[model samples]
Target: MTNPTLALTLGDVAGIGPEITAKALLAHPELREIARPVVIGDADAMRRGMRATGFDTDALVVIEDPREARNDPDTVELVQTGPSLADVPIGELSAAAGDGAYRFVVEACSLVRAGRADAIVTAPLNKAAMHAGGHDFAGHTELLAHEFGVKDYSLVLSAGDLYVFHLTTHVSLRRAIEDVTVERTTQVLNLAHGLARALGRPEERIAVAGLNPHAGENRLFGDEDADVLTPAIEAARERGIPVDGPIPADALFPAAMRRGRWNLLVACYHDQGHAPFKSVYGDDGVNITVGLPAVRVSVDHGTAFDIAGTGQANEASMVLSCVRAAELAPGWGAVVDALS
Candidate 1:
């Protein structure tokens, strides 16, 4: 079989997306062995990133089609997407940046849907910039969900042995609370369990974090944990998933990460997972969205507007994302089927 081709989307033009992606494609020399990577972004933006990141422009091979790409580490294959971003300001948010990032994602998605690419490994996009560009969706997850026409997806982040799936991400705290319904909770747990199996870990030890302090202290803090989270965990167990919790948020993650007690941990909200995950894993992390028609692994970091054009951005996370994408692509169909 041919190597799985990955459509790598360059995120917002104003951030380190292009710069880091350019650097990452070069940093991992074994990437070409794992999969063929075709960059999906503006040619000019990529050139700017190459210059800023100190990669020779000759490393980039501009291609109009995925079939034109060759599996060669010596060249960075690119399929330019979006409007001309040659004059767009770097290190600052702009509508052009937002629209440009969205264009790259759409093109990559189209390629994968058409069977031209096997998977997508995205760099970060700014939600504000995307909104300003008028293509408003919460973030990549929501946008991908909409494009794929499925609501049964979940955003999962992995670092070393720990995996976190958010129950409510990118919403107001009030809305986040309202979103922690038994149905959503059960669905997310199911998604998380499916994700573990998809990643080749059949021994899935899943943990659910409580929404309230001390897990509502048995009704002292709040009732969401007992009222919503508990039933979901019970239902998942009934479904034959190895699951446990509504454990106190404070005690749960530390023990899991340090003690290696669980393979998957479901968080109540965005920061509940992201905050501690970033703190411990930092640049060695990857974000995976499970239950999509195609496989997607992405850098867990955001658009670094501060270090956009400085050639100072680290590509470690992007490298990890690509590595994970390559590892998962071959088995992704089984995952989509399991989640679907």
Candidate 2:
């Protein structure tokens, strides 16, 4: 089988999305071997990114159709998904930049749904800018769910040996805890299990982190562990899912990282998982959305507005995002064979 077409979306013009994307494509020539990568964003912003990164190669080409891509290392194809952003200022959020980023994602998703692209790799987008531009969603996760009309989905972050799935994302800590019912936690666990399997893991162990310190210490702290977490874990196991805990938040992560005991950790809230995973992976992680209609992967880091136009951004995460997306494709093994 020929290489699958991987669609890339330029996140926010005011941030490091363009720079990192250009650098990733230029630095990793092997990307063209496994799939024809078609970039979806403003052409002008990409050009600026290419020049900023000193990637003076004819390998980059702009195409109108994803299928027309030739998978040539000498040509990274660009597909304009939004209007020209040549006048948009760098290092500063603007409605235009936010709209452009939103449109790019919408177009990329459309391609995947239409079967023109086999998978998607997204850069970072500024939430404030996205909201200012009239897109009222928390982040890419919500945007994707809304667009696809998917009722159930979860975010999984993979960094080297660590895998974390959040029980709640983009919400206040109080709201996060309130959202963690038995049903929601079980659903997240099931999604994590499916994602692990997709990534070649086989019914591996799962660890669920507690909502409170020391896992409620037998209700000395909170009833969430005893009342909510324990039942959820039991339900999962009863359904033939291998899982453990309501484990103490403080002890679970270190143990998982040190012993590799669990295939994935289900955190009760955002910071509970992200703080530990980011501490280990830093900026070298990929965020994957499970239960989507199409394979979608993104850099775990965000649009660093602080270093937007300075050419100081790292492309490692973005490159890994593309690699991860390729790995999750429907016929990824065949693509790997073609690469070999």
Candidate 3:
């Protein structure tokens, strides 16, 4: 089979997305061996990024189709998507930059749906800028879900063999607690298992972290773990999915990281998973949305406005996102089937 085609979306033009994309492609020479990356965004913004990041501008070649991409390590193939964003003011927010970011994703989704691309590896997009652009979505996961009309989705953060799936994200703590019902917990557990199976580890155990401290200390602190999370784990076990927990977050995360007890984990909310994962993995992790028709991977970090134009941003996560996208693209059909 030919190499998978990755539609790499350059997120918020004003932030570090463009700079990181340029840097990642240049920094990781092996990317050409795994996939053909076609950049989807404004050409002007990309040129500005190339110049700012000290990459040769002559390497950028704008093409109308993904099939036209040459997959050359020195060449950055771009499919210009939105309006010119070269003057959108790096290190600041602009409606034009926001709209351009939004448009790039839309175009990438269109490419995937049309079978022009096998997967998407996205750079960071500013949520505030996205809202300012009049497209109000929580983030890339939610936007991609909306574009694909998928409601049963979860934000999965992965670093190598470790995968953490969030039950609720981008919601207030109170709302998150309210939203952590048995149904949702079970859904996320199954999604986590689906991912494990997709990754060719169907027999690996899945761990569920508790919503309360010490997993509620057997009902001393809170009852969400006993009442909600436990039942979800039990039900998932009944379905013949190798599952464990309502384990305390503190113990579960440490064991997953150090001892290799479980490869798959279900986080109660965003920070429950994000904090420790980011702390340990840093630029090694990539965000994945399970239940989408096509594989979508993104840098776990956000658009860093403070270092936008300095060309000093680390492209590790961006490169990892692309690498993970290439790894997932081949078995993505199994992923789609398992999640659906």
Candidate 4:
């Protein structure tokens, strides 16, 4: 089979997205062997990135279609999506940069849906800038979910052997508590199972972290664990998904990371998963959107405006994101069908 073609969206041009993207390709030339990466953004912005990262100036080639990409190690294939963002101020938020980033994703979604691209590997986009540009979405996860017309999706943080799925993301703490219904929990469980199957581990163990401390400590703290979560776990088990939990958040993550008790984990909310994962994994982690039609992986870090143009942004996460996307692209169809 041919290598999967990936739409590599260079996110907020005003931030470190472009720099890291250029640097990832430059630093990891072997990425071309596994996937054909087509940059979906303004050509000038990518040129700026190549220059900022001291990349090969003569290597960038703008193609009219994704199929035209050569996946050459020395040549960076680009599919310009919108008007020039060459002059967008680095290290500062620009509505143009935000809109440009949004457009790049939209174009990528179009390509994926049309079967022109097999997956999407994204760099970070500034949410504030995207909102300022009038996109008014929560972030990349919500935006891509909307573009794909899917309501049952979760923001998943993945490193080697460990995957953390969030039940609620980009919401207030109170809202997060309110959103963790049994139905949503079950859906996320299935999504996690689907991810396991996609990764060739149909019997992979899954675990859920409690919403309250000590897993509500037998209802001394809160009833969400016993009342809301237990039923969902039971339902997942009945469906033949090997799962466990409503374990205390404090213990679940530590055991999962240190002892390898479980490979797939479901966190009740954003910080529950993000804080610990980011602390432990850092640039080694990549963000994934579960329940999309095609695989979408992103750098776990954010748009670093403080070091936007410094050429110091580490591309480790970006490189890993691309590699993960490529790895998942082959089996992603089975995942989507299972979710459906």
Best candidate according to lDDT = 4
Candidate 4 lDDT by residue in tens digits, 207-307: 99999999999999999999999999999999999998899999999999778899899999999999999988888999999988889999999999999
Across 1-340, the per-residue lDDT of candidate 3 in tens digits comes to: 4789999999998988888989988767899998899999988888888888999899899999999888889988999896677679988988788888889999999999998999998888888888998999988899999998998899999998888999999989999999999999888888888877877888999988989999999999999999998887888889999888889999999999878888899898999999999998898889998889999999999889998889998898988898899988888889888877
- In angstroms, the error of model 4 at 288 is 1.2
What's the ranking of the predictions by TM-score, best on top?
3, 1, 4, 2
Better of 3 and 4 by TM-score: 3
Query: Lowest summed lDDT over 10 consecutive residues: which window, candidate 2?
Result: 331-340
Candidates 3 and 4 compared: the better one by lDDT is 4
Residue 303 local lDDT, model 1: 92
- Counting clashing residue pairs in each candidate, in order, gives 0, 2, 0, 0
Candidate 2 steric clashes: 2
lDDT of 3 at 65: 95
Distance (Å) between predicted and true CA of 157, model 1? 0.5
lDDT of 2 at 48: 79
Pairs of residues at least 3 apart in sequence or in different chains that clash in candidate 4: none
Residue ranges of candidate 2 with Cα displaced over 4 Å: 57-60, 199-201, 331-340
List lDDT for all candidates, in order.
0.87, 0.82, 0.89, 0.91
The list of candidate 4 runs beyond 4 A from truth reads none
Model 2 clashing residue pairs (backbone): 59-74, 59-75
